[model samples]
Target chain A: MKKSYITAILLVVFLLTGCWDQRLLKDVRLLLGVGIDYQKGNKVIMSSVVTRNLEKKPPELISTTGSTPRDARINLQRKLIYVPDASKNRIVMLSEALARKGSILEVLDVFYRDPRSALNAKIAIVKGKAKDFLETQSKDNPDLTAFLDRQIVTSEAATIVPDVDLQSIRTGILDPGEDIMMPYMGLNKSNVEILGGALFHGQKLTGTLTPGETTVALLLANQKNKQTTLTLPIEKGVQMTVNILQSKRKLTIQPTGQSLKVSIDLQMNAEAIEMPFGDFSDQKTVAKFNHTLSEEINKEADKVIKKLQAANCDVLGIGRQLIAHHSSYWNQIDWNKEYPKINITSSTTINLTRNGILE
Target chain B: MGTRQADKISRLELFFFILQSVIGIGILSLPYTVFSESKTDAWIAVLLAGIAITINMMINWKLSSHFPSANLFDFLPTLLGKYLSKAVSVGYIVYFLAVAYLVLLLFGDIITRWVLPRTPVLAIYFLLVSTSIYLARESLSVITRFCVIVSIFLPVLLILMLVPLNSSHFIYIFPIGQTGLEAIFKGAKETSFSIIGYELLLVIYPFVKGNHTQIRKVILLSSAFLTLFYTFLVFNCVIFFSSEELEQIPEPILYMLKSFSFRVIERIDLLFLSIWIVTVLTTFVNYLFAASIGIKQLFHQNDHRHFTLAAGFLCLLCAEFTGDRFLVQKISDFLAKASFLFVAGIPLLLLLIIYMKKLRWHGR
Candidate 1:
């Protein structure tokens, strides 16, 4: 009994020692964000944000350019005090020029290969150079990467371009029915401005949506949030901007033989921000305003859908909807071929709850 | 030396043991499996399975409470004849060994896929065996105490799930009840695979204190907690990934976590993976203990120390022989069905036999 107890104690001692791979915070260099740009003749420029002590009076910015992201990252190793691990990287921004060249996948692989890379890190495409967007710093937000991170979460537009992080983008690119979409950003003075959203058909950038179009896309996709602002022409000259307090979208797929009909039902609660026809508190006027607003929102939504259809970018994930709802038909129809020709009907209803502080 | 002298565990320990058992490798893959079947309504399936598991747990607890200080091995022999009971006991031992093997394989696959890609499989297997062997050799009380200590880390692991909330697309979770009942039922079967570990009650039930009422409370609390945890995780994964995207990925929870970015932390999933090691270790320890106890019962050994070492060595050998990931998964699926039989079916049979025997004796 004594020997058995001693043996058990020894076993516990041997197993309990788990300090083999213990890493201290000081020993590891934490990477916050990575920026990729296109250099001359198929080469790439990589800029990364490495977190340093704030007391050190503004940390240095490290930039490296290479033929591939690995090369650029390797080059960056010499310049950076600590080696950047993409596992914890928050954002990866691609230059429009690099995106146009179709090198986003190559750049992303560096992060993907490392087990530590986070799948949820937001991916975006800048209008000009990726460095310009990364370099842009606002007085309000000293950490530019942190500021860009919020744009993906805060945007109310369904078309505000869904935040496509590394994992989702990889999944989207790999999956047949769905495509990837990333936030389109531009440098406005020193601030990083969200220009719109870039749509990817497969791994390549197919087209771009302006902010208004992106908002319309988001609305059609049923991603309209409480903060969604809908602008409507109330009269011949008066325009009213209403804040959507709550919204719900339902898509029903009706399969009749070889063809498929898609119906979209949008329910929204909105409050008027600006009423150009002066103080109109009457039930009749509010009813008329609601009808007009619904029609206008529907029209914008239809236009965005048409543009998306033309671009062959189903960022709305309509293919996924069909698979979930009409599985049999989805299996029968060639999604890539049928998706472009599928007819869509959208019906929207807007309920005016509060008209701001004004009457 | 009689049955009444055996130590009885608290209801809380029983609850934690159940929780630790159920939340094993299955948590990692359930989101993917359920998503493939039910798509958006995967969370619904988890809730339904929770209901089923709760019922099973109640029945098992009732049967167990009938004979205090006696495990499944003790009761089965009295319920069934000696030969049948011995055969069933051997079957259960095999089932327990399979669970240990599956856990090791899962540990190896996860480490290779997420953290240490180049690490040899043998080294990982050895590490798991050594850890589990040490835990299994300890007294039941010590093992339960250690499980409680490790189970405390689960809440912290759950908090890590909140990081992905910022990146979750709520629209993906919309069109609620879209898959309907048929799809939800199919998804429930897939999700139930993860809830199978609760059967450890078969071995530990003898060690539980209190009467039927207390046992019922422990079972209900444990199943309820597991159901909620599974539901929350599946719901989070569904909201985080589109149905189309979810269908393709093998592990949606990890994939979803990959989307988050913090100023101080970049890859929260890596941190999550590290913590999940504890979760896996507890589960492995539970199964190893059960397997050793089952062996000791078969051999009529007063001391379980020798059997524990032998079982650990056998589990390690079986895991090594399982070869690669795909084969291990195939073996695990087959073993899952077997586990359902031992955990649910055998206990049910024992209850029937016990009742029939009691009725006959009363009639006489």
Candidate 2:
């Protein structure tokens, strides 16, 4: 009788375990990439790239419109035979028009509120309609999501854009003293390319940086990736290319009489990757080369700083530094109005650490 | 020695028991809760709360050692007489039941929301309370043994917390002490609620076999480790998220873990939550066992086995009423306020009475 009772209990356990929350892979479609565009009459257009099976078949691009992102997703789900699961989504793109409206947090509220939404999806702002970028196909890679994601990631590694994601950008967007910079993608024929970066004052897109200016901005911000190469035009069109190996930035905010004096000191160690005009064999020549490069970098960095101040984007977190070290001063001034009037200066110093295989 | 129980736990088992009991669902939202009062200086508040809990633990130790073989309920009547002691015993039982109910409620809420939204919360409660009932029916030695085995996951959780520091900005906690000492102290007051389970020492002291010095050292060491562990986690969350972002997220640790997707593991938060369920179970079992002991003492029974199932049922039933989010928050705040009175106020008052009674006896 005891053995019979034990067998019955084992059978009950097997029959009753995990029947409610069992999500099978075959029953759901994985939505890998999402693109949000602002439509007429304040409607939202959501374009999703859904894959039935990632390895076996290519993904399909579907677009739906509704009042909000979740509403659009519900519309998108109704059309699909299987349920769309966004837990594995890797990228989320916003149109420049939608991003400019400062409704970024509103569009992303669903992702943050839903427990199953992916938080690490790469976030970007497209120059035109985000649906166009999502629909753009390539000959080499049929999956447009993977194609665009790889391009943004590669540009991030090259120090041409800031590595901002849905999770990483939330802090910047929410913080009063800081701003966010997202990778800006532009469509070129059948291919997509990361142009530079879209700068946001808070949640609104204020301005943008050119690719060269983006590298300089990121370098001065002390965010260096694997390969930060700079091509500087010297006198008589003698252009030189240098790869920045290491970078350090220091922000000092001091009270000068009535106002504050902000100075950004940027130091970098670089290697001459492709400089046919200069000789690094002599130490003195290398020193002069370093001086010349530093002078040019300082000029370019000054331009980037001026552009940032004009756009009211504190990408370098100078305002954050003020709030941290100079709270007394921070509380007194209206940072938004006073930011343009502040005396902010930057100086870059480049040390030629290596000359590559050449001397 | 004559008052010792049949199953006496060693110094090590006693250490794990105290350590496991003090940590539970509180650690997940600790940073968010403390950040509301102190902002970036929340880690300091955690340390202050740790020091206060240490002092409370010492007072409980001194009171328990005086009646070396008598647990809290066993010696209550000797100090307060039959009626007053019985009333206090009932209060203590109610406190234990409330704590168990909260743990089970929060466990079911988190699992249903995070891991299995489709799974019925009643099924989750059944799985948790049944396991707790099974282990709580055993002796103290078996429970501590289970606690010791589960403590291995604590280090794994620590390692997982370190991953978010890759993108952390330490400058977020700058302008130290900007919130002022008053706010910091208030933050400490807030954390005293999360650091609630140290009172278990009053109940388990009689069953632990050790010299007075060893017992005191073990208790102090466990509290110190707990304080440092909590401080590290809070510090990690503070630096990982900006002050504004930290205020917005209720569970910063889990949210921070959710952002990291490694090659092999897609969702680290789910893995962390699954492991965390075990710690929550251990904490629930600790409270269940304590309540059952109170029941045994009230009935004058030698074995606590009869009341374990009853106490588990009582907690499960109480948890069903707290389905509303606002109600959950209300009960949590009420429990925090009640914790100070039961865990510290009454225990200290009991010790005072014991001292006065001893003085009269000696004078005679």
Candidate 3:
């Protein structure tokens, strides 16, 4: 009697779990890539790459304009046969004009607020309208979603772009003492290429960094990825390619007379991958080579720092350091006002840990 | 007496029981709640709260040791009169029921908001209360066994917390002592609510077989370890989020896990919430068992199965009705205030009364 009663109860439990939240794959369109652009009259134009069928046909590109991103998505949904789902969304693109308006938090409020939305989706700032960027497709890479995703990943690995996602970017956007820089993409002959990084002052895109300057900025900020490769002319006609295996950076904030002086010291462990004429087997030659490489890196670092200061981007988190170490001064002066006027300097030290097999 | 003797648990089981009860939904948003008062020095507040809880646990142990063979309900009538003791026992039962309802409400709220939004909150509440009744109807020994077995998932939760360390900023917790002593103490007071489950020792003391000194050692060691664990969790959340950012996230731990995606699993927060369901079950079962024991003592019954069912139904009905978010918050605040009286206020008063009675007998 007891065993049968237990069996009856188990059967009831197994049979009674109704499918209230079950979502079928056939009933929804997978929105893999999304782009949001700023329009006049406080409107947003949202473009999306949605996959209707997985096997044969390519994904479709649709665009709509509404008061908010969610509103725009709803407007786009009305045109689709099936409901659009963003749970598997891989990338979110924003136009440079939209990012410049400095209401990024408002644009992204839906992603953070919705539990079903993808939080780790890669975010990028396109040089032109995001709607046009999403619509651009090359013959070789027909799927712009996967192509742009892989491009951002590879650029991050090469230390040409900072690794950022919807979730990780929140800290920089929300924190008052820091700023964020995202992968900047541009259209080149109907193909999208990662130009560099779009530097932000708070939520606004104030300036852009070139590819080489981005690497230097990331290295100085101690946010480098897998590898750091640089090709510099050591002499009048001698071009050498160096691969940095390791890097360390230190920033010291000191009060100097009327303003604060911030000094950055960067150390790099480098390997000479391509050198036309160099004998690292000798101690004196290695010392001279290190000196010349260090000098060249220092000059480039100076340019990146100046550009960052001019844009008022504290990606290095100088304001964070001051808030942590010197709160009294942090409370007294406004960081946005003082960031541009502060005296900032950087120096580099390079140690050639390895040379090519021939050397 | 016979069943109580047959249901004796070892020291390790008791330790697991207390540990599982103390760690619950409170840990999910503890860092955010404490930070509201303490700022960057929230971890220090957690440390201070841990010390305070350990001291309170010792006081409870001292009272229980005074009557080693009797539980709280069994000994209360000797201190207070028969009617007053009965009122006190009913009040204790009501408090446990309220806590169990709070647990159910929170569990249902999180499950609906995070994982299964389309599913009804009533379904989640029913599922939790039914399972709680199944184990709570049995003796304390069975509940402790279940707790010890599921303790394996505690380490998994800890390791999942460590994954967010890659993106964390340790400098966010700098200038630690700047929040000052006053704010830190207020933070400690706020923390005391989250770690409120340890007071179950009042009902658990008689069912464990150990001498006073040994039991004291076990209690001290277990409570101290819990304090350290709570401090570690709070410290991790503080370092992971800035003071400004922490304000925006209600459940910082879940939000932190939601941001990270592994190669295999895409949404880690969902996985965390599923495992957290187990801990929530243990916590709810603890309260249900305590309330059932109170009912059995009141009616002079030999079995507690029917009482367990009754209490479970009561909590489920209460949780279903208090669906409004503001009402749930108001209820939890009331429970936190009432917990001080039942967990510490009455026990200390009884101990003082016992001391005074002994002095009067010596004078006679």
Candidate 4:
């Protein structure tokens, strides 16, 4: 009798577990890209690309405005037939105006607070109207998310821009000694293109570095730059294109009695890929090529440093090193004002290891 | 009692039993909690808590080995008077039930917020308690065997946590002693509440099938293992996030996993959470077992199964009070403070009392 009673209870339990929150695939929309724009009325406009079938149809673009990003999402929820989920959201794009107006941190609160938010979603700043970028329809590309993802990943490998996600953004903003820089994107003739690095002082967008300047910043920051081609003029009109194989950076923060002295040393190994100058006849030419490459890198590095200093953006994490090793020096001054005045120097050395098939 | 005296647990079973009981919902928020006091030195605080709790575990073993084949419920009357012992047993019962309910409440809240939005909170509450009672209703030997089986998830949990280390910033844990020695100790004091499950050693020591020396070795090994386990995870969290970053994330371990997405599995963190439910069930069963034993001794009942059912009902009822996040946090602080008295304070007093009585007997 007890055995029968237990079996019956187990059967009832099996029956009672009918799916309470089963969301069918056809009934839910997968949000791929979200674009948040700050408006002048102390409001925000959120735009998202939602799709029913990923491989079959082009995703639809939708926009709504509210007092906050989450509020805008709620308002957008009203217009959609199916439930919109952001857990699988691939990318988040903010307009230049919105990022400049700041409070991007406040807008990001929804992503951090909601457990369903995709923490690893790639975030980029749109150089123009973010809504326009989100509104760009898929031409040959099946998915805009796929396009943007490829662009960001490709540029990250090529060292055109640094990789930044929502998680890094939150940490960078919260971190006292360091700031963050994200990929700056723009609407091209057909698809999205990575422009450069969008520098941020805390949550606010301070300025931007051009593509050339961004490459130098990345190299000085000890970040990888695969397939990066460096064109150096060994002679007056002779330019050699050297492909960077590996790179290393060493940053030194010297503490004096009055202030902190910061400098960065960079080393790179490269191979001549498209040397338009001439064939490498002897070891002397390779040495000359290496010297020319080093000088060119140093020149660009100095330019990048000057731009960063003028913008007062410490994307190299100079302040982080000071805080970590020399906290007493960090506590003495206001970093925001003193950062622009602090002189940062950079030196680079290049080694042309091989000349590919020519040698 | 004479017939059941043959039931004994092996050393490996005891190891897993202690492990499962100590690591529950506490792991999900422990690093974040410890960081609030120790900052970058949170791992140091975790290490200190391990050392402190091991001493307490040794004391429990000493007290329990004195009365072979007997639990705290049976042997308390010898140390304290009958009335006081009865009162202390009742207090322990309430403490166990309260802790079990808090774990249940936190479990339900995490599931509702992270996994299931539409399922009623009571559904998880009922399912967890029913399964826990099933495990708790068994003999000590069977429960120990179940714990051995449940511990196989530990290696998988470790592998999942290690996956994120490839991308973490090791520099975040730098300036280690910057939070200072005092803050680290304070964090260790705060962390003591999390290591509460070792107190079960006081009750289960006699059931362990070993000599006094073996029991001491087992206790020390489990305590060391738990300390390393917790400190390893805490160290990982410190490296993965800065103090500012950890402050905002309530569950650093889960949040760290959320950042890592495997190609085959989209969210490994959610999978970790699902497997973690089994570990949480082990803790629930441990507390329920402890509480029911207290009830049996207090009421002079031969069948502890009835007491286990009553205890489950009381846990569910109490869990309802901590439904909101604010009250859940409030009662969590209250439980942590109260745990020090029962798990640490009273155990020391009992050991001292037993020592004094032994001294008196020797003098006579």
Candidate 4: tens digits of C-alpha lDDT, residues A1-359? 97588668767765675578676777778888889887889898898878865457678778999999989988988998888988888888999999998678888888888877888988999988888776664444546544566678788888888877888778777877778889998877866677899988878898998777787788887776565766666788777777888888899888788766888888888888887656586888778777888998899889888878777778888877877788788889788887878867888999988788876
For model 4, how many clashes?
Answer: 0
The local lDDT score (0 to 100) that residue B257 gets in candidate 4 is 86
Query: In angstroms, how far off is B44's CA in candidate 1?
Result: 7.0
Q: Give the per-residue lDDT of model 1 (tens digit) for A269-321.
A: 88787775656578888888888888988888788777777767877778877
The whole-model C-alpha lDDT of candidate 2 against the native structure comes to 0.87
lDDT of candidate 2 over A246-320, digit per residue (tens): 999888889766788889999999988988867788999888888888999999999999988888888888888
To one decimal place, how large is model 2's interface RMSD in Å? Answer: 1.7
Model 4 Cα lDDT, one tens digit per residue, B1-364: 4425557788888988999899888888899999999999999999999999998888788788888877888888989988999899888988988889888999988888878788888877888888888889988888889989978898889889898887777777766688889999999998888778988887787778879898789889999999999999999998888668899888888888887788999898898998899999999999999889888878888878888988997888777655578888898899999999888889889999998999999999
Task: State the displacement of the C-alpha of residue A189, model 3, in Å, after optimal TM-score superposition.
Answer: 2.7
True contacts kept of 4: 0.50
Question: Native-vs-model 1 lDDT?
Answer: 0.76
Per-residue CA lDDT of model 3 for A62-85, tens digit only, reads 899999999999998899878999
Q: What is the TM-score of chain A alone in each candidate?
A: 0.85, 0.94, 0.94, 0.92
lDDT of 2 by residue, B1-364 (tens): 2354668898898888987898888888899999999999999999999999898898899999988888899889888899999999999999998999999988888888888899878778878887788899998889999999999999998999889989998988988999999999999999987788879888889888988888999999999999999999999999888888899899899999999988999899988998898889999999999999898888888889869989998888888656697899899998999999988899899889988988999999
Candidate 4 regions with alpha-carbon error over 4 angstroms: A1-18, A137-142, A188-191, A225-227, B3-6, B321-323
Which lDDT value does model 2 have at B110? 87
Interface RMSD of 3: 1.5
* DockQ value of candidate 2: 0.69
TM-score of 1: 0.73
